[model samples]
Target: MKSLDRKFTLWALAWPIFMELFLQTLLGTVDTLSVSQISDGAVAVVGLSNHLFSAMMTLFMVVASGAGILIAQRIGSQREEDARSLAMLSLKVCGVIGLVLSVFLYTQPGLIAQWLNVPEALIPLAESYIAIAGAGMVFTALSAVLGTALRSTGNTKAPMVVGVVINIVHVALNYAFIFGAFGFPEWGLAGVAVSTLVSKLLGTAILYFIFIEAFHRRIGWKELARYWDRSLLKEVLHIGWPLGINMSAWVLTQLVIYVFLATLGVKELAAKTYMNTLESFCFTLGYAVALALQIQVAHLFGAGRTRDAYKATYKALWIGLAVVTVNALLLFSLGRQLLGIFTDDAQVIAIGISLLGLNLILQPGKMLNMALTNALNAVGDTRYTMVISFVCMWLVATGGSYVLGLHWGWGIVGVYICMIADEYIRGILCLYRWRGQKYLRQAEAEPALGVGLSAREQELVQA
Candidate 1:
């Protein structure tokens, strides 16, 4: 009865999701800031390794993302049992996927660094950092899956609370290990990686405790024992594979752009690293809104409130665009001060400032894509979004970055210009698809579960 417990409006849902994502992004920024003290080369190598890990992180989402959607719809349809089963199933699947990716990262760190074409001088540090940090992928995967389950229930606050703890501990560990503070050895990059691994492990454990305590309370471990569900797993994969691939394509495209920057030199890569950290603040606004919107829309769709679901995404999209416009402007105005916090190098500061300026135009387009693609996914329209992402990311972003930045010698500036084009191109296509409203036609495929006392309870607890 307590399984599908919470109701959410956009703001109620989004702010906590924003805080959680902000904390996660801050963790990455904190790592870069700490390593910036060592050398620009250190920042560059660590960034490369992080990109590789991130690309693999998308693979974990293949299961978590799909399962989250399934759980949300099932709960909306009043299928409490199915919703709980999907949550357990996601944890098992993500754990296995995470373990496999972890081993790959640990064993092939050097090879991946080479594939990224990182400078020879940076490869050794990158390899070591990757192995240590990558070994913890399982913890992150578990944390993510647990968070996905909670979010589907509209309980964003739990994950946000856990994130706050993870960030604090990670910062303290980084200081002790990176600088010999608290009598810890100054392990530098290795210390940073270890701190990350420890924090993620703690996050996973806490999230698991919360999951069992909150959702599986009556049954507890007995509920956890209800794991395998191949037919359900297939349904999740049916919805998720395109999404996972789409997510990977986006991250890989960003990494490819970084690779182009790496070809220019470590300075360029370091500059972009700072740029990315700063840019994360802008994207988080839209991403948080989009995620919250997806949960709300899925519930609405499952309840057969088709018109309300359609209106929700559009309403949220405009609001997201306005907020990000302000965020991007504020970030650009304080660009020098922010870049200064990361490094003392004037060139890096100058280059980072330039990217921040371009982001004024870039942020809106990115918001558009996040808002629409997520809304589309909420209605089970995954394949169309995936195809557009594949086309726009590679042909427009990747190829253009190479031709403009490398071949044309226009440098990071040209690469960024092309990047802006990629975002808008995808944004426009997403707009067109959402307008078509084919999702309405597909709604009958996933009808609601039979109504009961629990469904009446949910109706009484309105958003």
Candidate 2:
């Protein structure tokens, strides 16, 4: 492969990730809009159920994240063969976890609904939706790891294509099943779940094929057995365990916030859901840049170029902030018009507009937090992020939301303030760590891949 300049490579990778995220976000928005047409209560049910789905995705992160870091580092170190092995390992691990969680969540749908404090009227709707959507958890898990693996190898476009396919399939199926169009049965919430599951399953299959090609057909039985090395598992877990814990903690914090919001009323719940979906449109840009930064930072760190890693992070942060700022401005300007697509409720649109205005204030801090945290994690500063996140999220954000939103009767506005506070706090800390040399110590703890690539890989590199 030819070596590309850092700046060119960064955007080359970031754009596809951005589009993939946008399409995925759009997918959820369509689901919300379709269900919104049925009833606001149904919209609330789908929204809350999807939040639970996000929390459940923590399991996929555990394996996908660990494997992703290692894969990037291995590619950086020019250990292509080992990277292939790690990709295969990540897929197997995520697939198994997905299967188990799918069964667990699907069978205990009511449990999940109850856990979220779904209203009595909405409980059945949420349960029925989650029960069917829960099976897609497996596809989600596998697709996440597969996409990450491909991205680690700098094949981000493949995942973007797969996402396009998912969007197309999901929208078509949703239209047909949602209203019984073209002779299809009207399944309502269940129909929405079917669209999600079928699209994810198909997308997962596509990603699997792409992973096989990207990794040089490395998923065969003999190759899988060969790649399942105990040491690789240990290395992956070393990096992924902290990330998974951190992600789970964050998910729990969000769920707690949702619990607080749910107490307000279903209208608040629906508003929060719309806010989240729309917020994704802006945050996706920041997250895309951050994710690209992670791969670049990991590659630099793997090559022992710590200073370049820092430079890459700062550069990515600037780009992320700019993109996010533009997105925020667009969202702020058109918040009402855009939100009105999901529902005709003037009140919901008003609340959502206010939330988007708050998001403009939230964007810069969020951009920094997203970029720097991912850069920190890429270089093995995972534990610091995990610990600080746990502390700030629960102590500051979670606790503040309850005191401000519920206790003070400030409602969703109070929760947004808490969220903004946490983002800035974490963002400042991450910035401090990036600017200083304290995080360098963690680099010494990274996995060693010896001096150079194998002769076969070396020959391929020379060729």
Candidate 3:
């Protein structure tokens, strides 16, 4: 049977993706845990550097996201060759973009440290970490695109396997480098950076081969070298540009919020850092399910099964809500213990527990937003979602965070109120959008997939 003909439940698709994201989240958590052994300054350095690293990743997000959406739809429609071509195009685009941005990070690390308002004592550590870790962006982009390609084709297991390997390598190397174990010299935060970069590069290499062997079978080297489908590339960028912009906008606003948090002092910064690591458990689960929904929805659309697409969206939403709610409750109950895993500081743990209390209310809205936004984007309604995200993220989340947290002296708790507001406000809009079926109408109204498979795709739709 064709891959597309294979039936899938929400869990069948989501669990592997969830495990992959869960391991990915664990990778960051491990980094934080390892770095915490050194000093609060080291933890702060890693945290600040990661903020910049995430923002710089906008380049990969656009291409990977766009390619994933397109490939899913193509594969859903049974245009395997077209899907393969798109997978290659996305890698080619993100590879060059990633390398160029990597160069920027290597050269201008201090600028980012300053931009984040890194405390004076931690500036050197933050700058060095970013420079070293940023070198891995190219590898990271390649691996991410490969993973996205695999997931789009309903091969989520491959990426999950790759993630497991990546995290294992990262953890082992982190232990050796951070503590100078096994005769390795202790390099502190620098060691953490080197371990992370090397592990990511390894993961990228593994995923690259998996992607080619799985998707590029029997295509000659000459054929591969000669094929550069400009139109497909253009279509990918057309779909990806808004997503890239949306991500960049969100990152910039987050950077601004970090600056506001910085004004509150180092302890608050550390508290926020620890809080984020804990919250990742909830958000990442929601994200994993939402991504699965996007793929499933795209497949349904590709098959011209519009009603099933709607059915799948609501089904995925409820699944995500259930998971996020349970996650929130668990985190709330174990807040102190979880926060203590990162630091022994009572004050930081106290701040984090209070913040998790806020997540009780925030997680549900966030889960909804994650599901609906990706559902919208998968159906090619990216522009509307981007616009709404931009407005709500800035006006409500960013601005309100500053006013409530800093000005009101409510600190992290107040900032969280703004965050909950942002999630629900935009989430409601996304739900309404999906319920109204605006994204479906827009996707159907668009021109057909035009990547040389137009005729065949049209036939598939007609049949």
lDDT score, candidate 2, position 56: 83
lDDT of 1 by residue, 324-428 (tens): 999999998998998999999999898898788799999999999889999998878999989999998999899999999999999999988888998888888
Query: lDDT of each prediction vs. the true structure?
Result: 0.86, 0.84, 0.83
The deviation in Å at residue 171 for candidate 1 is 0.5
Q: How accurate is candidate 2 locally (lDDT)?
A: 0.84
lDDT, residue 338, candidate 2: 86
Deviating ranges (above 4 Å) for candidate 1: 1-6, 216-219, 222-226, 444-463
TM-score result, candidate 3: 0.94
Cα TM-score per model: 0.93, 0.93, 0.94
The clash tally of candidate 2 reads 0
- Candidate 3 residue lDDT tens string, 151-181: 9888889899999999999999999998889
**How many clashing residue pairs are found in candidate 3?**
0
How much does candidate 1 score in TM-score?
0.93
